[model samples]
Target: MMGGNLTGTVRLTRLALRRDRIQLPLWILGTTVLSSTSYTAVREQFPTEADRVTALRTAVDAPAILMLRNAPTGTSDGDMMAFQILAFLAVLAGFMSTLAVVRHTRQNEETGRSELIGSMVVGRHASLTAAMIVTAGANLVLAALLALALIGNGLPAAGSVAFGLGVGAAGLTFAAIAAVAAQVSQGARAANGIAAAAIGAAYLVRGLGDAFGEVQPDGYTMTSAWPSWLSPIGWTTLVQPFAGNRWAVLVLPAVFFAALLGTAFALADRRDIGMGMLAARPGPARAAAGLLSPLGLAWRLQRGTLFGWAVAIGLFGVTIGSLAGTVEDAFAGNEGAARTIRELGGGGALSDAFFTAMLAMVGAMAAGYVVQAMLRLRSEEAGGRVEPVLATATGRLRWLGGHLVVAAFGAVALLLLAGVSAGLVAGLGNGDLGDRLVDLGAAALVQAAPALIMIGYVVLLFGLAPRLTVALAWLGYAVSLVFGQLGELLNLPQAVRDVSPFSHVPALPSADVTATPLVLLGVVAVALGAAGLILFRRRDLAL
Candidate 1:
């Protein structure tokens, strides 16, 4: 019976591979490139044993850095690189796996494609089995590539393999979690949201445990609490790839993946086709009074997401702010640390440099929310939801304008919230609230230009090439994020650095704010936006 239920699995897996060729390659390539580049940069930055030791000492005392990265395990360059990139790599792998599983499973069911496939000779479990197989294969490939890249960069082969396997295990665990989420949520969006929340919760649990964990006298070994064991991300770092390479820690994720996969399959067997195990409740029969206009409807649709982003960003700001003093104290006497900070911050006051980097990070995060909001237009159009609305008195311009306004203004509000929260927290710690609030708030606001440019790019894609908008929009954001954050570290070419809009924004607090670049960026944003609106009004809806 089980064998029959997986009929046509190979064919379906092949089909999925074909469909995701571009996306899968991009995900793998981008991750590998980032990891490899980061490793190379770290090696170059700290060339001697003394420098590595100093960095390890600094990282040990700084809780914020520990929360962001794992405690250094050894003075070896490979160990340092592994510690620096493990958390980031684990998160990336989980994100890739979640998106792949949800896109193949829940998204297909939502669009009725799975139903069509089921009507053929395929069995009940074939589609999901195929998706799992393809996703697992992609993760394995990513793991192999990352391992090979690490070895090619002069790292130990055994440690590289351990790191790669740890990352891959995290991805597999999340893929199974996403599969279970797909069975529990009624729609693709909701499934993705649930999976994302799970990922976020896991990271938070890991970060909290690491932040409070006890470190040995060596300043390299750490012993985390029970909360660390609860998160698969934490498991990845616990493997300790370069220092001791705790082979047993990998078993945690293996067991979790098995349990989650079993639960997903069981849930799938109990649910109806094109529906989830958890049924959604029906909405009220009458629309609310505030749902009269397109703008109101847009707000109604996006308010939940906007609220979530605002809270998350604000909390993140506060957390980073609270760690600023610890970071400064940790690096006070270290010349290598100071030089590295100056180089990364483009040379300035150490405290200002730290804030500048934090604000830039917040800006990148805000761009993600802004791009998501802007992409709602493409989603509505693709789902055939826009036709009915346009069939009424509402015109294309009004509908587009509604979402655009939210994307723009919501970006501003979220940035302000993050800035204010960080400033307030840091100010209280330093005993000067008013001045810190204004300065940090202005810093966050200056970073908004990149997000605005991101929206402009998405709008342009939606109008000129609606079918390619989603992929290209996200690709643009990813490029900007990588360049903006790591360009200096990687010693990337000037032209490459210039590609990101954030690169033009003067690093506030660290340096004097110049108006020329800001004005140029604003002009470019307006031009792109105007062109998009014009093209959207002229062209017929692709759907």
Candidate 2:
């Protein structure tokens, strides 16, 4: 019999379904909707061979894009359509799978729910098995929905199957990875942290490999450098679904998953229930100076996230900045390509439009950190951990203020860092570091205040509507992204673009800073943050 298997898996399955009925279905629905939306948008953008060829030429020559999306295979243009989104979609699929599996295994054990079940006649491997099965089942549904969505949109039938299978294979492989992680960690939080780290590592690996194709410049044949083959994101692109549809590559992930599943079972057999093969040290009973208040506690919980955001945004700044010289070259050398880049933005001027476009996207990406950090306060409160702090001498306003300190300050920091980094690099390329850095930093910060306003709303939602906060806030971000980036490309309604704070931000590189728009956006942020804190103070704490 498999270790960690329990006869109660059936009961646990039903129980798990009941608990996740809304959340799981919502996740599935969101992915399905997004996939459909992407399919429609991509198809519309590159409907002809000429459009595809131009895209391939621009993308292949651009290291930034190749780093972002896998290199196109010079295959059919229609098949190449999937290239635009395959990286992100694969990452999302893998992340969702790892999260779902980790939630059932380590997270459940962390909360002691798994222990409660472990005390029942659960077999050694049943809980993990049942969890994997359910997770795999969810992947299947995703696969079906994804395939149906693509094919329904007129994608080739075989290519759609390959696309869906690639997604499912990624989910399965990550599920197996989480299974192994669950066996090594003493608690769910650690397991979850580890799995998330793994997921991130996978993305980084794929990015690196995509940037410098699995081969090294000085070619020593680094076997361990096989991150490309190791990452499912890299593997999915190998399928080349919309093009030649390399069907056999799909089995690589499937086989890797089988191997991982075998290892997870072996590890499970060796470990005791609710315990890992590795021993864990107990957390300090005494509080640190940083843990003294609600906001501080929120900071303690969220500091890792803040640091990560700063680093990522800064690097992204470097990338965009480094491309500044390249943009000028393209502007001078190639009119057709420049127009395409311009079509991508600046109505006409190549460099200014490019910077404006890059700045807007980077600024938007900065919110990924803000939204989650803002919502962290709500998670603690709803999870029953905040009541004890509130019962103490802490006032609700001060507590809320602490987390807000991180959110507000953190957003400002990211914008400045991103701008400075991008500007410094871009300016250096133009041989004027001092002036360039100042220009980039100023523009980046100009947009930062309004970005803060959006972050404030995420926090507000958390305080006022805990259950709906995460989804609604992220949805708002998506709306902003669409409006800021594609509103012009898609010719979306004027009212739709007007809904985002960013749509109002003048392309500062091309236009001088105007105080009216800046002041209004700043006021919005202030009001939203104030309202969130006030509401939080008035609301009842959970438990």
- lDDT for each candidate structure: 0.82, 0.71
Candidate 1 lDDT, tens digit per residue, 177-215?
Answer: 999999998776677677777877888888777877887
In the predicted model 1, the residue pairs found to clash are none
lDDT score of residue 480 within candidate 2: 73
> Any runs in candidate 1 off by more than 4 Å, and if so which?
220-226, 320-351, 428-431, 534-543
Tens digit per residue, CA lDDT, model 2, 1-543 = 543355778877777667567656666676676667666666677687677666666654444555556756543533555666666667667766776776677666655676788777887677787788788888889889888988887877888888888877877888888889889977554565566556667766877666565322322111113557778777877777776688888889988899998998899889777688789767699989878766678777778777877777888899888778777765465455566556554554677667776777667766656766676665566446677777899887877788888887888888889888988888877888888788778778877755687777976886778655645675676557656655654455689777778777767575677888888887888888778878777877742
The candidate that wins on lDDT is: 1
Q: Residue 58 error for model 2, in Å?
A: 2.8
